[model samples]
Target: MGDILAHESELLGLVKEKDLVAAFDNGDQKVFFDLWEEHISSSIRDGDSFAQKLEFYLHIHFAIYLLKYSVGRPDKEELDEKISYFKTYLETKGAALSQTTEFLPFYALPFVPNPMVHPSFKELFQDSWTPELKLKLIKFLALISKASNTPKLLTIYKENGQSNKEILQQLHQQLVEAERRSVTYLKRYNKIQADYHNLIGVTAELVDSLEATVSGKMITPEYLQSVCVRLFSNQMRQSLAHSVDFTRPGTASTMLRASLAPVKLKDVPLLPSLDYEKLKKDLILGSDRLKAFLLQALRWRLTTSHPGEQRETVLQAYISNDLLDCYSHNQRSVLQLLHSTSDVVRQYMARLINAFASLAEGRLYLAQNTKVLQMLEGRLKEEDKDIITRENVLGALQKFSLRRPLQTAMIQDGLIFWLVDVLKDPDCLSDYTLEYSVALLMNLCLRSTGKNMCAKVAGLVLKVLSDLLGHENHEIQPYVNGALYSILSVPSIREEARAMVP
Candidate 1:
C-alpha cells in the first residue's frame, strides 16, 4: 500500500531471478513447501514497530512468491487457502511476517548464516573454518544487530517520538483502506473480464454460485449454479464457463450468439412449442400457473443452460399475440429481484426486464404494471451505490420514456426532478450514466407531461440543458436540444426563456 520497503529490492530481485527459482526447483518439493508453510505460519503476526512490521511483510511477500514458483506447484487450493488467510490478516491488522524467527535457514552473507532463514548454511563453516572467516562473521553480527535496532534508535532520538503510535495507526488505516479498495477493483476487473468472454463459452451451461465473497461463495440457490468467478485469472473463469457454466453474460449478446449453438434439442424443442397455439383453449384463463411454469422453464434454459433454443421463442410463446396474462403477472417476481442488493442479481434481472421492454408487447406489459418501472426509478434516485447497477437502471428508464404512459408515470413520480439534479453535477457521473440519463431526460421532456413538469422549474431545466451544450461528450447534444425544445414549448416557460435573454 506504500512504497516497497528497503528490503524489497532483495525480495523482488529473488522473484525476478526465474533462474534462481529454477535452480532451487527439483524432484523433492515437500521440504520447500513445508518450510514455506512453517515460516509463514509462525512469522506472520503483528510487529511492535513500523520498521519491524514492514520487515515481516517483506518475508510474506517472498513466501507468496514461493507458492507461485512453477516447478513445485502445489494444489491450487493450498495457494488459495494461504492467500485468503493472508489477506484476512492484512485486512484486520496489516500484512507482516517476522524476520527474527529462528525458522527457515538461509545465508545472507559470505558464509554468514542467517539464524532466521539461512541457519542451514552454518554447517558449511563447521568443516572449513578460518580466523578471517570468524572475524568476518563477528563483523556481520555487529552490522545485523545495528541494522535490527535502527528503528528503536530512531524512536529514541526523534523529536516527539511518541507520535509513532498515532502515525502507525493513521498509516495502517490508510494501508488497510487502500488494500481493500485495490482488492475490490481487482475482483471487479476479473468479473468484467470473465463476462466479456461469456459469448465465447457458448458450449457451457450458465451457473451462478459463489465460493467466497472476494466476489465470494453463493449461499443462495444460485451459489453453485455454474460460475467460476474464482481466484485464478484467465484460466479460472474459462474452465468454469466451459465445464461448469457458472455464469452467463447477462447481456443479450450471449443470448443471441448461444441461440445459434449446436446443442441438442427435442423433436419439437418444447420452448417454441406453444408459440402458435391459436386454439381458444391456448389462451391464458385464470392465474395461468401452467403458462408461468412454461415461462420459468424457458427462463433458466436461456440464462443458466446452453442455448437449447429461443429467448424470442419463449417471449412469443409466453405472450401470444392475443395474450399477456403471464407476462404482466410475473412483475411481482421481477420486483423482488429488482430490489435485490446484489449488483450481480440486479444486473441480470435488469437485463431480463430490458428484454421485456424491448418490444411493443413487452412495453405494453410493463405499462400495465408500472411497479417494475417505478422500482427502477426509485433505485436510480437513491444514492449511487453501484455504478453498473445505476447504469443499467438509467439505461432502462431511458428506454421507458419512449412510451408516453411510462413518461407520465415517471413524471408523476417526480423523475424529472432527479434527472435535473443529476445533470447539474455531471462531473460525478460516468460517461455512460451521463449519456443514458440525458437521453432519458430528452425523451421524457418531449412528452406533454414532461414539458409541463419542466415548466414548473423551467429556469433550472434551461440552465442544465444550456450547460450540457458545453459538455465534452458530443453525444448528449441531440438530447439537450430535444429537451430544450420541449421545455421551451410551454407559453410561460417560453416567456421566461425570452425574458432571460441579454
Candidate 2:
C-alpha cells in the first residue's frame, strides 16, 4: 500500500505537470493512456484510500481523452477491464451528488472509448435522475457535438440505431418538460437562464441528429418557436421587475443589449417573438433616449458578424425575431416620431425604416400608414448631407412599392422621379442597393398605372437601362431587362425605348 501510494502520488504529479489537453495536442496520447492504465491497476489493488486520492481533475482529463481519441480503434481487452473497473468506482461515488460534481463522472460514461463500455449510456440518461444532473449531462453532450464534427454521443447513436430511438424520445420529452417548469415555476432569473440554455443546447443536437438520421416527427418548428417565445417572455418579465432609466446614454441601450442577447441554439433557426406593444409602451414610446438606444442596438445586432471561422455566418434567429416589425406597427406612434424636427431623431428613424423594410409585413404596415409614407417620401426629396439617410429612405420606398397598393400610394408620392434620379446619379451605388432600385422599377412597370409613370420618365429610364446593359454587373441585367420589357411592351414607349437601345 505504501509503495502504491507513492506511485499514485508520482503519477498525479506527472499528470498535473503535463496538462491533459496539452498532452493530447502534443501527440502524447499513448503515454497518457499508459499512465491511466498504471493508475487504475494501482488503485484497484491499493484500496479505496488510494482510489480517493486519484483526484477529480485526473478523471476529467481521462474522460476528455476518451472522447477526444478513443473512437474507431479495435477493442482492447486490457482497456475494457480498466474501464469496467473505473465504471464501478464511479457508480459507487455518484449517489445524490451536487450538480457541480455530478457532471465530472457522468461525462465519461458516453465517451468511454470502448463500444461495450457505454452500451447503455442512453439507458443511464432516460432512467430516473435529478433534473440538474440531466441538464448538465445534456449540456456536456451538446458541447461535445459543437466542438467537433463527430461527437461520441452521435457516433453511439449511429452505430446503435433502433436502440437509441426510445432514449432520444425520452430525452426530448424531458427537455420540453424541464423548459416548461423553468419558465413557469423558477423565479431566479440566472437559474432559469442556465436551465433553458442547456435545454436548448441539447435540443439543437437532438433536432439535427434526428433530422439527418430519422424521418419521423420528433420536434416541429412550431414547437421550437413556442419554446423560444416562452424563454423570451421569461427574460423580459424578469427585466421589467426593476426600473430602467432610458435617458442616460447607454443606460437603456446597455440594458436592452444584455437583456435581448439572441437566444442561440446550434443549428436551430427559431427566434423568440417580441410583444411590440409591451416593449414600446414600456421602453420606447415617450422617451427619446430609450428610442435612440433601441435604434443603436438594432443597428449593432444587424451588423455584427461572428468570428471568421465560425460555421454559421449570420444569426437567422435575430433576423426572424421581428422586433422592428412590432415597433413599426405600434398604432403609428413610432411613425409619428419619425417626423420629429431633430436631425438625430431623423437619422435614427431612417435607420429604423431601413430595418423595418427588410420584412414584407413591416413594409405593408408602413404602406398602410399614410403619414409614414409621406415622411419617407419627403426625406427622399430633401438634399441631406448624410447619404445613408437618403439611401435608407429610398430603400424603404423600394420595399413598400413591392406591394401593389403601396406602389400606387408611393407613385402618388413621386417615387418614380426619385428612382430615375438615383439611377442617373454619377456616383456608383452598391450592387445590392442598385438591385433594390431595379427590382422596385420591375414591380412598378408590371402594371398600367406604373407603366404610365415609367412612360413619363421613359427617356431618362431608357438612358439608365442602356447604360446598365453595358455595365459589368450581371446581377442587375435581369431586373433591367424586366423593367425594359414592361416599358417597351407599352405601345406608347416602345419606339422611344428601342431608339435608345443602341
Candidate 3:
C-alpha cells in the first residue's frame, strides 16, 4: 500500500506537465495513461477487478485536469459523457458536474476499493458471510456514518520540525526531570514538617505537665525527684560533652599544633581543672550539683601528680581554720559534708581525707580531730551506702592506721574487731574492699592493742587469714602475709594457727 501511494504521488507530481513528464522522458507516460483509462472504463462497467485496487490520486487528477482546461480538447466528448454519468452517480459531492437532494458514496476513481471489494473487508467475510451480507454490512456502516454526520479525519500540524509523538515524548521527559527535583525537595519538606510537629507536641505536653504540677494535682514526691534527677542528668551530660577546661600544658589540640618542633602530646585528664582558690571556694559553697562536679575536679588534681604537695596545700587551710570549726559555712564546718546526702560529696571527702592522712603531719592533724575518723568508720559500717563511697571510707581508715596514734585510736574504737569480722567474708567484697581491708588489718595488728583485739576472736581471725592465703590478687597477698605474721605474735593466735590442719 505504501509503494502504491508513493508511485501514485510521483505520477500526480509530473501530471502538471503537458505529456506527464514523470512517466515519459524521465518516466513512462503511455503506460500510466493506458492503465488509468482501462481502470476507469472497467470500474464504470461493473466495479470488477479495478474495484479491488484503490487509485485515490487518479480520481482527483481527472477532476483537476478538466476543471483547468474547460475549452476544446481531444478527450472532451468522452470526458463530457463520463462526467455526465458520474454527475448523476456522485450527486452533491461532484456538484460542478451535477447536483442532487441526497448524498452519494461513488465519488471515487476506478480500481479504488469500495468497502465490499477491499481486501480487509473480503478477509472479514471470507468464509463467514456471503456476498449479500458484505453489501448489507457496507450499507449499515454508511447509514451509521450519515446518521452521526461524521467528518473525514484531519492530520495534526507539526511544531518546530517535531511531530506530535516527538513533542509528546519531550514533554514526558521534562515531566520526569521535574519529578526528580520534586522528590528531593519533598523529602526535605517532610522532614522539616515532622520536626516542627514533634516540637509542638513536646511543648504542649510540657505545658500540660507544668500546669498540673502548679495546681498540685496528680503529682507525687517521687515524680518530682525523678524529674529533678533527669534534668540534672541531662545538664551534666551536656556540660561534659561541651567542657573546655584545657588543663596542663600540651594537653589541648591547639597547643600541640602550635609547636614548630616535633613533640608528643600528653593524654588529657579525665576531668578539667580550675585555679586552686576558685576550686576551693566553689567546693565549699557551691550547690550540690556544682559540688559534685568540683569533687571530681579535686580528685583529678590530688591524684595525678605532686599529690603530697597538693595534700599539704589543702591541709594549710584546715590547719589555720581548725579541722572541726567553721571555714565560713553558716557555722557548720566544711568537713560536715562527709555526712551530706550526696554520695559524690561523701566519696570525694573520704578520698581527700585519705590523701590528707597519707602524710605524718596530715595524719597528726586528723588525729587531733577524731570526728572525721568516726564518720569514716560509720560509713564503712553502713551496708546499704554506695559501694564506692564505702570503699573510699575503708581506704581513709587504712591511711589513718599508718600513724601510731591513729592506729591506737582505731583499735580503741574496736575497728580491728570490725575489720576481722568483715575480712572473714572476703569473698563477698570487691577487690578494692578486700585489698583495703587486709592492708588496714595488717597495719592495726602491728600494734599490741590490735593483736589483743584479734586475740578475742583468735580462732576466727586465724581461719579468715588462712582462707585469704590462697587469694589470687598478688597485691592483696603482701597485705595478707603481713597481717598473718603480725597477728600470730599473740601466743593464743599462734596456738590457734598451729592447731589448724595444713
Best by lDDT: 3
What's the lDDT for all of these models? 0.54, 0.56, 0.57
Better of 1 and 3 by lDDT: 3
Model 2, range 301-389, lDDT digits (tens) per residue? 34442322221222333334434343245554555546655666667778877766766545654555566778777776773655666
Residue runs of model 3 more than 4 Å from their true location after superposition: 1-285, 305-331
User: Number of clashes in model 3?
Assistant: 6
Residue 339 lDDT in candidate 1: 64
Runs in model 1 with CA error above 4 Å? 1-311, 318-332
Q: Give residue 282's error in model 1 in angstroms.
A: 26
Worst 10 residues of 3 by lDDT: 96-105
lDDT of 2 at 67: 32
Give the TM-score (vs. native) of candidate 3. Answer: 0.42
Given candidate 2, what's the lDDT at residue 486? 70
Predicted structure 2: lDDT: 0.56
lDDT of 1 by residue, 1-502 (tens): 2346746644543443332223224312344334333332233323235334433333343334334343664566665454444433432333122123331122111112122233343433342322333344334334433444367557466634667777889999999999999999999988775654453242223322211434664444243333324322454455444454334545234433443447565543332232223221222221233223223333443344223244555555545642333344553343455565555555555565665665565666666665667678877776366677678778777777788777788889998898999889998889998988898888888788888888899889888888899999876776787678667768999998888889
